[model samples]
Structure formats: C-alpha cells, structure tokens
Target: MAPETPAEPEPMPAPAVILVQPQLAENVGTTARAMHNCGLGDLRLVEPREDWLGDKAVAAASGADAVLRAARAYPTTAAAVADLHRVLATTARRRDMVKPLTTPRQAAQTLGGVIAAGHRAGVLFGPERAGLGNDDVALADAIIEVPLNPAYRSLNLAQAVLLVGYEWFQAHGGPFDMAPPASDSPPATQADLDNLHHHLFRELEDCGFLRSEEKRPGMKRNIRNIFQRAGLSVQEVRTLHGIVKELRHGRR
Candidate 1:
C-alpha cells in the first residue's frame, strides 16, 4: 500500500477588527492597511462617518484594498456584535465600568482560545474624539487597556488597531506558526456573562445593595470586576446564576 500524505492543519481564525463610528475615511483605510500587515482580514465598521470605499480610503490603505473591499458596515454596535460570541473593547482612559482589563498581548492570547474553539470574536475601537461609550463597553466581556506611557496614552484609531492586530498575529502564528495553548473549557460567552450581570444587578437592586444613586455606578462596576476578573467558565457562570436565583427566592 502506498504511504498516505500527512493532512495539513486548518489555519487559525483571526478576530474581526471593528471600528465604532470612525470619523475619517483615511483612518479607516490606514487601519485596513494595518490589518493586512498583521495577517488579519475581517474588518467591521459601526456608523462610519465617511465613505470608507472612497478614493481617500483606498489611497490610505496603500495596497490593502482587499481588506477594505471585504469590510462590512453595521448600524450600531449592538447589531455589529449580534453574531459574535466574544467581544473586547479598547479604551485609553480608565472607565467607570468593572470589566476585566488586559493588555494587547493578553487580549491576543485570550482570542487564541476563542479561535481554537471556532467561536466568532472581535475587538472594538472607538471614534477619534472619544473612546467607546459605556454602553458599548458594557457589551464586551472584557476590556483591552493597553499599557502605555503615563504621560501620554493617546493612540490614533489605526495605531491602536495595528498594535492589537500585531500582537494577535504574533501570538497566533507569525513567522513560527506556533500553536495556541489549549483551553479546558470554553469561557462564558458575552451573552452569558451579560445575563449573569443583569440578574445579579437586579437582585442587588431589589435587596437595596445598590441604593445610593451617587455611588451605584462605582459599586456596580466594582461588583462586575470581581466576577469579570475571575474569567468564569460557562459552568461557573451557570452556577453563579443559580446562586443568585437561590438567594433571591429561597430554595426551590
């Protein structure tokens, strides 16, 4: 019998790069160019102010038209992430939200696990004037907060995307094509976590745990951080939901 040839492994999937309300078409084009350089292809836009397919964008993309050509546009952040299983939003300034914070490298590693499981994942970038709104950040399972010089942490839209994409590319397989580390169980999806968060918050509200209007936001964020930092698994999240329900209504 003839020897069988070894089968090639499937290529690792890349996370989508989503620009939320991008202000400039040129920036969008450069962001596309950056994605191309990092071996990333998926590009999504939420309420882009300019025509990203126009000439300025193409010129800014340099030679990465394919990425721009295949890019998708969404009416809102919620709609953009409707099908994504995991989401990470980037922010330069410290937010009042209590989400798990990670660096570019760490976010890349997390995405590796998401990709390994064949789940859709994406990174959200906000507009130039201001970063992602609290509502947008609320939709994310975690936050990507790059550690930069304390004096100046500002990064243009393309630069931010490129930095994150570069880290992701390197982690996934850059020049070496290194395999990602295996995960025991899939982490809780954003939807699952969001449900947990809402359920817990509602119970807390009913119990008067979050009574102070002035302090409620900070307190809620702190509570969220406690769980977000835990990197809960799906089962863990379910257990928590049950615990919350049990606490609220006594034993069934």
Candidate 2:
C-alpha cells in the first residue's frame, strides 16, 4: 500500500483588527499590510473618515489588497464588536475602569486560548489622535496596554495594531496543543451583552434609576464594566434578561 500524507494543520484563528474612527486611508492601508504580515485578514472599521479601500489605501497596502478588499466597515463600535466573543481594546493611557489589563503578548496568549476554544475574538484600536475613548474601552472585555517608555508613549494607529498582531502571530499555535478549558455553556456574544445593556438601562430609566444627566454616563459605564468583567455565559445573559423583565413587570 502507498504511504498516505498526513493531514495539514488547520490555520490559526486570527482575531479581527477593529479600527474605530480611523482618520486616514493611508493608515488603514498600512494597517492592512501589517495585518497581512501577521496572517490576519479580518479588518473592521468603525466610522472611518476616509475611504479605506480607495486608491490611496490600496497603494499604501502594497500587495496586501486582500485584507483591504475584505475589510468591513461598521457604524459604531458596538456594531463592530457585536458578534465577537472576546474583545480587547488597545489604549495608551490608564483608565478609571477595573477591567483586566494585559500586554500585547499576554493578550495574544489569551486570544489564542479563546480561539482555540472555538470562539471569535477581536482587538479594538481607536482613532489615530485620541486613541480609545472611555465608551469604547468599556465595551472591551480587557485592556491591552503596551508597556512602552513612560516618558514618551506615542504610537500611531498602524504601529499599535502591528505590535499586537505580531505578538498574536507569534503566539498563534502555542495554545493549540493544550486542551481548551471546559465550559457548560458558550460565552455570551457582544450582541447578547449589548441587548442586556440596553434592556437593563431602559428598565433603569423607566424606574428613575438614571435621572442624573451629569452622572448617567459614568454610571452606565460602571455597569458595563461590571458585567464585562463577569465573563457571563449565554445562559447567564438569558437569565439576567429574564430577571430584568420580571422586575419590570412587577412594577407595572
């Protein structure tokens, strides 16, 4: 009998690189090139100011036209991450939230584990100038802060994405040999969490729980951070929805 060739290993599950409100097409192109270099192809843009797949972007992407051509644009950060099971936001400065913090390498390891378990993950990069806002950061399950020089920590959009992407590429297959952690239920998607947020917020508003316009934003963010850190499962989210609905019905 002829010897049979071994089946090839499956390609690593690459996380989506999401750019929020990116300002320049060239930056988007360069970002695409960087992603391509790391074997990543999912490029998502939220409210980009420039045409990401335009001539300038294409020229800047060089031969990475595949990433640019397949890029998806979203209207909001929430919409961009709605389908993701795990999300990490890249930030330059410390925030007031209590989410888990990790370096690019650490985040890459975590993302690799998540993907190995058959869940989708993504990293969010904010605008070129301001980076991620508190609102954008709150949506993430964790924060990725590159431990750069404290004296002058300044990186452009593509540079930041490239740093993380490189780490992710390096760490991709490291987790595949190990067994994924067991779970009773699948993790909640960002869309499920968004629905829970909106549902809970509506009930809170109806019950006059968020009457203070000055504090409402902060309060909402705190609530989001709490749930985000909980790592709620799909069943847990549904139970919470039921709890919220029951509470609202009791009042009526």
Candidate 3:
C-alpha cells in the first residue's frame, strides 16, 4: 500500500508583506522570519538594500528561509502593493500622511471582512532607521500601530510585521477547512509568555530597544508580538485570564 498521507491543513487567504525601502539585510531576514512564524508566505520588497537571500538574512531568519526563497522585489511601494485591495502601513511614529490609525485588533476585524469579500490585502513596513515617509504612508488605506509605552516608543521591523500578521492570522482562522493552527489553539501560557519575554528582551538587547535608563522601553509592544506569535496555548492561557482579573480588581 502507498504510504499513509498526513492530515492536510485548512485553507486561508494570503497576506502580502510589502517592505518599502527596507534598508538592511538583517532586518529583511528577521522580517522573513516573522512572516514565516505567522503563516504568511508572500514577501514583496520595494528597493531592499541587501540581498534578502544572502546568508546574513537566511541565518537571521533561523528557519524561515522558505519565506525568503519566495520573496519578490519591486522598485516602488505602489508597485509592490498594486495588486492588493486592502493595504495597511505599520509605524510607531506619527506620519503626516493623513491616514486613520487602527489598532491591530481592529485591523484584524477589518481584514476578516476584506478577505470575506475575496480581495487580497497588503501590509506595509517602512525603513529601519527613519521609518515610512509621507509618500509611503499615503500608499496605505489605514495606519496600523501597536500601543507602546508613551515615554519610549520603538519596535523592531520584524516584530511589527509579526503583530499585524498574527492579527490577520487569528481572524483568518488559518487555512480553509483545516484552519491551520489558530482559532482552535489555546491562548498563551504565562510560562510561554515569560519564555517569550526572555527571548524578546534578548533580541531587544541585541537591537538596543532597551536602553540603559529604561530596561523595558516599549515593552508592551514587544509583549504584543510575543502574545501574537505564541497563539495562546489552551492550557497555558490561564495566566492571561488571571492577569486580566487582577487588573480589573486593581482598578477597583
């Protein structure tokens, strides 16, 4: 008899990550890793500075090279997002671009509607150093920002990509009939978040997100990424439930 076939995953809509004027190889690699973690396969690079397929990127990606392998490069952000019907731009800083700001949750809700309508969507990330410029922001239908600490605001490009991708993934419910691994997956574990926190802070240390004075600058944003990627393991999510209860009580 033929070998037993493995179970197939559910079908889900695809989201294209459009990196406009991405400046570094390492960031591109990290972003690819982020996309892979969230089940997003489409990578569109608009004028990337380094080789996305170079060893620096693949190594940085860890095991997300498949995302890198399927990457597409373009000359402009508009061109990169041309085929997409819904577009979102990710930014931590204010853009004078005149776009409405939507939290990841709201964006996720909206994305679900967009997908239901059978239209493809794209999410935009700006350059590492300066971030998305006015023209770049103007290209998107909405502005997506993670709620970060007011005093200190900064996020890694890949982390930002992961957050939005996670929201979309959660809403999309993974592949069609199979539903990938989301929806049914339990909420995150405190232990998992703690572990994620450790890994994230280390990544932050590597990127200098946590400066000397403030150890956890914009930590909530980073935490959001961890929470987003972890997919809330069912048994592990009691921690989140307890934390919410404590917060509500504290407010009293």
**Alpha-carbon TM-score of each model against the true structure:** 0.67, 0.66, 0.65
Candidate 1: TM-score? 0.67
Model 1 ranges off by over 4 Å = 1-8, 177-252
Q: What does each candidate score in C-alpha RMSD?
A: 21.9, 23.4, 18.4
| The candidate that achieves the highest TM-score relative to the unseen native structure | 1
Better of 1 and 3 by TM-score: 1
Clashing pairs in 1: none
Instruction: Put down candidate 1 lDDT per residue, 1-252, tens digits, no spaces.
Output: 989999988678899999999999999999999999998999999999999999999999999989999999999999999999999999998888789999999999999999888899999999997999999999999999888999999999999999999899888864574555556667898888889999999999999989999999999899988998898888899999999999899965
How accurate locally is residue 159 in candidate 3, as Cα lDDT from 0 to 100? Answer: 86
lDDT of 3 by residue, 1-252 (tens): 999999786576767888888888889999988888778899999999889999899999999999999999999888898888999888888876667899887888877778778899888888987889888888889999888787877887898888888877777755547545555556656676676555545655666656765646566566667677766675556565555445444566
Residue-level error in angstroms, candidate 2, position 93: 0.9
Question: Which lDDT value does model 1 have at 14?
Answer: 93
Q: Judge candidate 2 against the unseen true structure and give its global Cα lDDT, from 0 to 1.
A: 0.93
Candidate 1 displacement at residue 224 in angstroms: 64
Global lDDT scores for all candidate models: 0.92, 0.93, 0.80
The candidate that wins on lDDT is 2
**Residue-by-residue lDDT tens digits, candidate 2, 122-217:** 999999999999999999999999999999889998899889999987787345446546778889999999999999999999999999999999
